[model samples]
Target: MSSVRRAVSAPAARLGLVRALVGGYTLVYLARRRKMLRKVVRTDPAMFAPVGPVRALRRPVPAPVADALNDATLVSTALFTLGAGHRLIGPLHSALLSWTLSYRNSWSMIFHTDNALVVHTLVLGASRAADAVSADALLARGPQPAAHPRYHWPLRLMNASTTAVYLLSGVSKVARADGWSWATGDSLRRQVAIDGVRKEVFGSHAAPTAYALYRHKALFTLFAVGSLILELGAPLSLLGRRFGRLWAVSWFGMHWGIRAIMGIKFRYQMSGVAFAAWFDVERLLELARRTR
Candidate 1:
């Protein structure tokens, strides 16, 4: 038990850095999508199929109310990112963010990619992630709290949460009737082909790479096998930092490849922010200190 605890132990600064990166990404994400979100609220109420926290609503809220909630979420997200008023704003930001995104997803399709971002935010908001490299920290009257298990557990949870996503994906694939045959690439190839066709049907350009590589069964097979390994082996990251970072880089590369072949973007994962907990992001602060 002691060894396990020690393995997960991390500095408060590390958590703070992750909080900044994840929060910053979400802030920018919401900002860029503000107009689209506004339009969504004005969308036909008949299309609203609530999911997540939004499921609590029997029907869509008034457009004005939805709009107000969106605005509040954006403002609070800024406060969350800066780590200002964390005690009061942190949990508030998490709830608002969850609702805002859930409401957005209620229309059309649910974006599974945002799941990790939401879960990570919930963990950070509930923890003492603002203890370092934050406005809250800067304004503190006393010395900063030393690194301890309290700081480390949240990160461990985040790491586990990330791993669970991939693990579940891999397990689902293997649990299918075809089982391990998924590694043969037939399913993946068909998925890419379908995605390309869907894009063209929707008046968007299909990924040329998908067409170019469509006939390369060997290449597809390699990609399929690699994907399974990455997903099923995600837990290896929890074993050590080196393994975790390597896995993260590999996963990031996989997302880029997916973007190229399918025109499907997992923006958070591609931005590398989704995997920030696996890294010593506090080194960025250390480097800044050294440069000064």
Candidate 2:
């Protein structure tokens, strides 16, 4: 019981730092997509196949209304990131984000890549993530609460949620009829070829690396095996910090490799923000303190 408790517990600053990183990334991510989202709203109402929280809507929202909601979400997100009025703004940000992303996904294709980011944000927004290293902490009138299980458990939950996503992805791949043969590289090679073809057909440039490496059977075999290991073995990250860090770095590299091969970018994973929970992000705060 003691060991279990220890494993789940962490300094409040760790959660605070994670909140900032996730929130900041989300802010930037949404800001960059603002124009694109505006264009998406104006897409044909016939294309609106609602998913997630947006399923409540029977039809597409007016472009002006969507623009207003998006701008509101951005404002709440900024407040959430700053850890100001968090008791109210935190959950508000989460809900707004969820609605905005869900609505965005309703148009054409669902972006599975944003799942982890949304889950992480939801967890942080509902917890005491602003207890330290935040505007809330700095403005508090008295001493802040000491580290406790509440702060730590959310981190554990976030880590486990991330692991589950990878595990499910691995399971989906292996649960197919071909199953274990997926590691033999034929499937991966075919996928790369198909993606390249699709891009070319759509008037977009295909990844040059895909064409260049088409004949390298051995290389594709290695990539296939590595991907399976990375996804299926994601649970190993829960064992300890060393294992977790290794897992994070490995996944980070894997996303980059996928980008190079298929031109399909999982920007969150590539940016390293997706794996922030796996490390002691509080060290970043400590470093800043020392440098000051």
Candidate 3:
């Protein structure tokens, strides 16, 4: 093959391999880890909060909410992954998922990007290269005039919304700060103190260290410095494709780590959608060509 051919084909090939692995993992994860997923989804108090109902709002559903949430989540996630209710189901569940995450959840520390990941994946997953990637693609460039099987409207909505949100987040930090470097331990500590549930959840995790880091001038200041750098650069992601993708890589690792080490599932159902924020969907096509 010519050099040009190779250049065009590599990404799709890589994408395919990733998809297969992701699919296999999803299969295994569903078959073997369903119980575990159920456990975490229910037991983790921080994962959900009892909000006022459409009418009056009830206390924790008599039966543990996790099992209930799992059943519903399974229904939505299944429809999304199977390409069942592409539009109607995915966005509805996405909204519900976003609403459930509260300031208390560890995942909420990052401006609730998890919601975007989940909704985008549920809808666009069919097109994903990873099992977490799902079979519902949100941004197919082909099959126009009919239903574009490549991408879903919900995913596009998410991409646009995420870009807007990231932009807003960057603007807020920059607007208030002494020019970035504002995230330090003090800020984190203050944030936790204000949010009752966060204080309860994470304060328990690192306990003495949480306080020590909160008080130690050097450590707090150092973390604070790193925090703003990330937040400030976040909006630049809106500038173009490359920036968004690089951000996706970091965000993906960050959330995945939260799940593995912290025992918290941060957007488990939508991790693959992060790729859409940065890379062109066409890249998948190129990878597909190479593998072929």
Candidate 4:
């Protein structure tokens, strides 16, 4: 028990930093999408197909109820970010936010980018993230413990969940397409060309890089193989911090390459938030300070 506790003991400050970044980003995201969220209630009932736990609600959610829930979600997200009454408020925040996300996906194309952020938020909610540098921590009268499993486990779990997404995505691609054919240049060339056609159909310009890369089968094949390697090796992130860092850099680079070639962006995955556990928050802060 002692060894386990020691193993998971994380600096309270690190946990606090992760909480603030994750929460703040989430709050910003929700705020930016507030208009779209409101439209959810106003959307036609014919378009609704409940997802996740929202399916348990049976019938379509009344607009007024949906409006109220959306409001509550925004408010709770704010509270969660501030780490105010986190223990009690966190679960409420998670539940409401989950509902809103499920509702959104039910009505249109599912945006997988936010999935990582949501998973991280839920893990934070379930942990004692407010033990430091938060409203709850500030309110406490006595000195707090320097380290605890409550903090580390959540980060670990979040890390695992994020990595699982990559692994599953890679596995799905392999399962659906089968063999190395999917990783060949011809496949990439076909995909890029198809995407280009898709963009033209929608009256949008395809990624400029896509056109340039389409004619180069050999180079595109290399890219396809690299992508496969990155995705398939995602589980190596669970090995340790070193492996996690390696995976983060490789994954981040992979996304950048994808954007350059396919003109696609997985913002959340590429933003370093999904791989937050691989690097030390304090070290990043220190480096930022040094640059100034």
The candidate that achieves the highest lDDT relative to the unseen native structure:
1
Which lDDT tens digits does candidate 2 get at residues 213-265? Answer: 99999999999899899889988888878998898899899899899999999
User: Candidate 1: misplaced stretches above 4 Å?
Assistant: 1-7
Sequence-dependent TM-score of model 4 = 0.91
**lDDT-best of 2 and 4:** 2
Q: Candidate 2, after superposition: displacement of residue 87 in Å?
A: 1.2
How many pairs of residues collide in each model?
0, 0, 27, 1
TM-score, per-candidate, Cα-based: 0.96, 0.95, 0.48, 0.91
Candidate 1's residue-wise lDDT over 186-232, tens digit each? 99999988888888899998888999999999999999999999999
The TM-score between candidate 3 and the true structure equals 0.48
Answer with 3 or 4, whichever has the higher TM-score.
4
Worst-scoring 10-residue span by lDDT in model 4 = 277-286
Order candidates by TM-score, high to low.
Answer: 1, 2, 4, 3
Q: Which stretches of candidate 3 lie over 4 Å from their true place?
A: 1-49, 52-56, 60-69, 85-88, 91-114, 118-156, 163-223, 250-272
- Looking at model 1, the pairs that clash are none
Worst 10 residues of 2 by lDDT: 141-150
